[model samples]
Target: MKELQHLNKYFRKYRFKLLVGIIITMVARIFQLVMPSYVKKSIEVVEGYIGNNILKSEAKEMLLEYILIIVGAALLSGFFTFLMRQTIINVSRYIEYDLKNEVFDHYQLLSLNFYKKNRTGDLMNRISEDVNQVRLYGGPAIMYGIQTLTLFVCLVPLMFIKAPVLALYALLPLPILSVLIYQISKIIHKRSTIVQEFLSTLSTFTQESFSGISVIKAYALEPKVNAELNNLALDGKSKSMDLAKVNAWFFPLMILLIGISNIFVIYIGGKQYIDGEIASIGIIAEFILYVNMLTWPVAVVGWVTSIVQRAEASQKRINQFLQEEPNIVSTVKEETPIKGKIEFKNVTFTYEDTNITALNNISFTVNKGQTVAILGKTGSGKSTILDLIARLYDIDSGEILIDDVPIKELNLQSLRQSIGAVPQDAFLFSDTIKNNIKFGKENSTDEEIIAVAKKAVVHENIMGFNKQYETVLGERGITLSGGQKQRVSIARALLKDPQIYLFDDCLSAVDTETEEEILNQLKKESKNKTTLIVSHRVSSAKNADKIIVLENGKLIQEGTHEELNSVEGYYKELYMHQLSEKEK
Candidate 1:
């Protein structure tokens, strides 16, 4: 219960709904308590009519009256129970919806460092299963817990009034029952936590396997994966069964105590009545009914305790995730217009958990409307430079500037909106081709979409499709060929018409002829915008106004393509190799 203290804010948010539910629960319990007296009266009526102490006609009328009263009491209890369920249950659903939304929104704000440290399946568990666990505690656990306690409070006194000695006997074993449940609940809490974590592992395994199914099948690794999956499933089952075993023992223990209490009432109360201590059999009947009524509250102790402990475990996980502070955050909300100038001044950075420096002492500048290209071998830190400009990861030292203004001090959304980046991996959503192209600008016109597609040299391919611009893609755009996906990415970036463009091997999949044509089109279209291209191929950067060559983590050479080609260096080597390939 102490672990669930954070839920007070949610309860307060829907206090009116919670209050109405509680009031209805109280009314239902009161109506339930009122029902036993009718049972007692009905017994008395039977005894009275049998012993000839009342007229048969009057007894018949009284019996019917008592029956009607009992029905009315039952109806009230059912009505209020239904109303309470509607209010409290729906409140839990509403809170779940709000909580999931808030967590997902927070995920978008988190930095790449956080994602690198966490697993996708674990995060998914927090959003879906963990949220449901919290809802169960706030919903049925709270609602039924209140009802059980209230029922116990109202009916216990009535039991004592009917037979004090029997009431004491019936209550003697309750302390033991509570202790037993308390101990079992701790074990349940530990087991439930283990089960949830295992489930997360299973989800992650399935997600990764499906995403890389082609590789798995090519490598013939189905047997190995299946065995691992089976082991995980078995582990989850074992933990669940451990919790279930405790639950199995808990209910019978409650029933054993309740069964003993019932026996004590019949034996002791019967002796008291025979000895003339109890005046009528009706009093004994009412006492028996009260004990029966008390049974559920005692039994529910285990069930609600299980719910609370599960929620406590789940809440701790959720709160820890929510408390994480992002590595990158905007320092300003409003700023002057960007003029497309980008400068890196001796910037250095290393990825988390790795000692290798990805970039070191890097410094360069691209004036507005000028084109710059970064030439490097694999892992020579070409893409890292572009990532730094977008502020995806903060620099370890030094500063990046745009038009003499520090990039970090600029608003994140505004800074990103000023530059259009086409990454090495072409990613597309499962939506219509037009929608994917229009993602950068939601209000883009159809003509604008077509115009950009034509410039990117993908309009003819799209028009050849059955639905053209309305064609929906499969997951990760798997339905399209690699070159088609890259062209779509190019078209999406072209439509943005940003102040600057960052192309990271954007045409790797296309044919050399088509790639050249698209590059020419981009050069024509973005003549006035700052453009940076990062590519391993010398051909891609040959036409740039300036080329910077990198080796290891440092810039080794900087000049125009003609100047680099004239020199006997790595650039010349790459150019000679490509010239030989073209000759073939």
Candidate 2:
């Protein structure tokens, strides 16, 4: 319930509709209460005529009038009940929509480290399944709760006013029912939380299995995967059964208590009637009607309690993520223009998850229109430099500056927008080739897309496809080959035409001939842009204005291509080895 207080703002947001629903509920119950009284009147009128208290014609007219009033009141009550559901249930749906958007927006604001700490499937389950559970509380539980309260308010006092002793006996089992519900509800809350957590785990395992199905088949691990999934399903079934067992107690308990109340109404009221302590037997019938009227609401109490407990458990999960503050917050509100002069001054960074130092006291400066190539062996921190430049992770020590302004002081969006980065592992969405390219620049013309595809040397391959750029890709662009995916990724960055271009081993998949063609085009296209190309091939770095070599997270060499080649060091050795391979 404390976690559920988060929804109070939404309740206030649609307070007008909820108020209307409440009014409709009260009116419906009031009209429904009119039925028992009219029923009593009809029964009394029949008794009067039998005892020679009234004529047949007058009695018939009175009975017909009472029947019509009862029918009319029933129809009105049904109509108002319909309106009550419309107003209240609709508000619940509105709140669900708002809550999902709120969670998604918060997810976007969080840093990459947050994603590293959480699984995708668990995040998805929180936004979807957990939210659905909360919706049950927001809609049906609230509606039935109000309905029960309205019936109690209108019916209970009427019963006591007519016959105090009978009312006392009829309500005797309710306190016991409440005590049972309290104990059951606590158990339900604990079990429901466990069930929801197990569901998240199951969802995570299933999602990962599906996403990596190709790997499973390649390794012939289908049997192993299926056995694991079966184990998870069996565990989930056990947890769900535990919850169902507790819930199964609700209705039978309610019915038993209600049955006892009905018996009390009959026996107690009958004794009073024979003693002439009551005016008529119709009063007993009226009391019986009132007790029966409470049946659904009383039955719903347990159901509502179960729903609230489940909802509270789900809300607590949702609140855990919603309260997370983003680590990388934009310091500047106003947008700053970028001219792509990047400087790294004694930057040190370590991966938090692995605690591996990716960069150590790395310092470099790139002028506004300089082309710098970074050459390094695997795990030598070439890619980390580009990530730091993009401000993906803040440095552990030292400062980064963009166009002479502290990187943190500049607008984060502006800084990132100015850079066009093609990572070592290119990722594409399950979308058309044209749309994937257009992701870099929405509303791009067909001519512009074709031009960039040619620049990236992927235009011919795309034209060979059946649908050209219109072909829809498989998940993560698996429909294309590795080289094609990389080229298409290059075309996307080329289309962006940002002030700074960071190419991180993007041409590793292409042949030397195609790589040369793409490099020539890139040299022409990026003439005035500040470019940083991180590659293993010396052919790619030979034409750069400056080259930097890294070894074991430390800068070992920095010079022009000719100077580095003249020196007998790592860059020259790599150049000689690559030159020999080309000669072969």
Candidate 3:
């Protein structure tokens, strides 16, 4: 109930439609009430003829007129019911569309850290399955629940009017049913939450296994992965059965309670009529019809209670996602174009839940047209530096500037658009080569794409395929070799033609000759653009205008190859080891 209260804002957005729907529901129910009243009149009309209140022919004519009124009320009730559904149900669908788009937009705003902490399949389930459950409650459950309430209120009083003793007798078991519904709803909500969480875990497990199926096959671990997946499926089934067990007990018990009410109306009302306390059989007959009307609403109360509980559980999960604040908030009021120059002034950063910093007191400057190479040992903070340049992660302390403007002060869209980065992973969507290169620059022409692909040295390989640039790649470009994927990633960046380009070990998969060829082409095209390369191999760093070497998160060396080689430090030590390995 509390979870639904939070959704009042969404309801308020379409309140007028909801109000009209409710009014129509009331009118339809009033017409329904007329049918039961006509049944009483039909019985009384025959009794009146026997008692001589009217002539026999007159009584027959009055009965025929009541019959027409009953039929007319029934038709009007159907029409109003249709109108109610058209207004209320359609609005629920519109709200569902808006809510989904809002959640997806929030996802786009979230930074890398959030993705690192959550699974893809878990998020997907929250958006798809959870939202759908909420829709069920918002639409049909709401309409039916209210209709039940209104019918209960209207029918019970009319029942009392026909036979006061029978109405009070029939209502004796209601308080008991209400108490049971409250208790059962609490348990149902708790169990439903557990079921939904298990569903999320199952979704995550399936997604991860499917994505890593190739690795499992290579390692010959299919049996183990399959066993784990089966266990999750079994667990999900067990919980569902548990919930089904609760429902099995709850729904039947509700029917039994309603049956008790009907039994009382028959036994007690029969005694009253025989004792001459009622005017005629019509009062008792009308009371029975009214009690039957109460039955449908009572049953619906139980059904909607279950729906409400499930919706509450789903709402709790979705609300948690909506509450998370996006790490990157763009607050820049003034926007300017980047000049490609970059400066890091005593920058420091540390990953979450860690004490050790990734970059400590790091300071460096790259002129607008310079090529800078970053060299470091494994876990020496090289890729972290490149990530900071594009604001993938924010720095803990100190300043990062682009063209004399603080990177933090620039709008995120313009900031990221100014830099073209190719990370070490080289992720490619499942699409054609032409579409992948044209991702960032959607309006890029065929001629522009060909030029960049040649600069990245991937044009020849693409031409070798049967479809050339139009050739479709599998997931993550699985059909392409490692070197091919890297070059394609580089080609994607080259097509952007951003002012600054950051490459993080992008050529590690290629041979030395191919790496040199790609690098040469990159240098030629990016002669006046800021280019930063993070590489492990000495060959990749030898020609950089400036080489910055890191060790233990500190800048221990900075200069060209000749200047660094003249000293006895980490750079020279790595250079000597490479030279001896080549000699061997």
Candidate 4:
């Protein structure tokens, strides 16, 4: 219930609708109460005729009038009930929509470390499954709760006014029912939390299995995966059954109490009439109708309690993520124009998850329009340099500057928008090739897409497809060859035409011939743009304005290709080794 306080703003947002729904619920109950009283009058009119106290014509006329009034009241009540659902239930849907968007927007603001610490499936479940449970609380639970309260307020007083002693006996079992519900609700709250958590675990396992189906098939581990899924499903079923068992107690208990109330009404009212305490048998019928009118609302008490308990459990999970503060926050509000002069002064960063230092007190400067190539072995922090420049993670110690301004002082959005980065692993969405390339520049023309595709040396391969750029790719661009995906990613970055281009070994999958062609085209296009190419190939770095070598998270060498080629260092040795491989 405390966690559910998060929805208060949404309640305030749609307060008018909820107010109308409450009024409608009350009006409907008021109209519905007219039925039992009218039923009593109809029975009394028949009684008058039987005793010769009224003429037959008078009795028939009064009976027809009462029936018409009862029918009219029922119709009006039904109509208002419809209106009540429209207002309250619809507000719940609106809140669900807003809450999902809120969660997704927060997920985007969170840093990469948050994602590294969480699973994709668990995140998906919170926004989808957990939110749905909360919706039940917002919609049906609220609607039924209002209806119950309205009936209890109106019907209870009418019952006492008509026959006080009979009313007392009829409502005798209600307090006992409430006490039992309170105890059951506690168990339900605890079990509901467990069930929702297990649902997240199950969802995570299923999503991972689907995403990595290729890996499972390649490793011939389908049987193992299937067995694991069975185990998860079985456990999920067990938890769900445990909750169902508790819920099963609700209806029978409600029925048992309701039956006791009915028996008390009949037995006590009949005894009172025999003793001359009450006037007419019509009074007993009216009391019975009043008690029966309360049946659904009273029965729904346990159901509404269960719904609220489940909602609280789900909201608690949602609040956990909603309360998370993003590690990286933009300090500047105004957009800052970028000229792409990047500087790293004594930067040292350690991966928070792994606690491995990727960069150790390394410093370098790249002026606007300078093309610097980074050469390094595996885990030499090449990719980390690109990430730092993009401000993906704040440095542990030291400062980074863009255009002579401290990176934190610049608008994060403006800085990233000014840079075009193509990472090592090319990730293409499950969309058409044209759309995937257009992701970098949404409003790009067809000619512009073709021009960049040609520049990346992927134009011919795209033309080979039946639909060319319009061809829809499989997940992560599995429809294309590895080299083709990389080139398409390069085309995307080229289309952006940003001030800084960070190509993090994007050409690793392509052959040397295609790489050379692409590099030559890049030189022409990136004439006055700052470019950083992180690659392992010497051929790729030989033509750069400057090349820096890194080993074991430390800067080892920095020089022009001509200077490094003339010296006995890592760069020259790598060039010779690659040249021998080419000759072979």
Q: Identify the superior model by lDDT, candidate 2 or candidate 3.
A: 2
Which numbered prediction scores highest in TM-score against the true structure?
A: 4
Superposed Cα deviation of residue 345, candidate 4 (Å): 0.9
TM-scores of the candidates are 0.96, 0.97, 0.92, 0.98
Q: Where is the poorest 10-residue window by lDDT in model 3?
A: 246-255
For all predictions, the C-alpha RMSD in Å is 1.7, 1.5, 2.7, 1.2
Stretches of model 3 off by over 4 angstroms after superposition: 46-68, 463-472, 572-584
* Candidate 3 lDDT over residue span 253-369, tens digit each: 767877888788778878887898877778767777777777778777777888899989998988888888887777786666788899999999998745668999999999999
Judged by lDDT against the true structure, how good is candidate 2? 0.93
What local lDDT score does residue 196 receive in model 3, on the 0 to 100 scale? 88
Q: What C-alpha lDDT values do all the predictions have?
A: 0.88, 0.93, 0.87, 0.93
Segments of candidate 4 deviating more than 4 angstroms: none
Superposing every Cα of model 3 onto the true structure, what RMSD results?
Answer: 2.7
Off by over 4 Å in 1: 1-3
- What digit string (tens of lDDT, one per residue) describes model 1 on residues 1-584? 66567678888999999999999999999998877889889889889988999789999899999999999999999999999899889989988988898889999999988998888888998899988999998889878998998988887776777677878887778899988988999898898888777777878888888878889999999999999888988887888888788779877998899888888878888888899987778877787777778788888888889888889888877888888999999999786577799988998888875767888998888899988889888888899889888889998987899888998888888888988899999999999999999987889999999999999999999999999999999878887899999999999999998998999998899989998899899899789899999887777899998999888878888889999999999899988998899889
Of 2 and 4, the candidate ahead on TM-score is 4
lDDT of 1: 0.88
Q: Is candidate 1 or candidate 2 better by TM-score?
A: 2
Candidate ordering by TM-score (highest first): 4, 2, 1, 3
Worst 10 residues of 4 by lDDT: 198-207
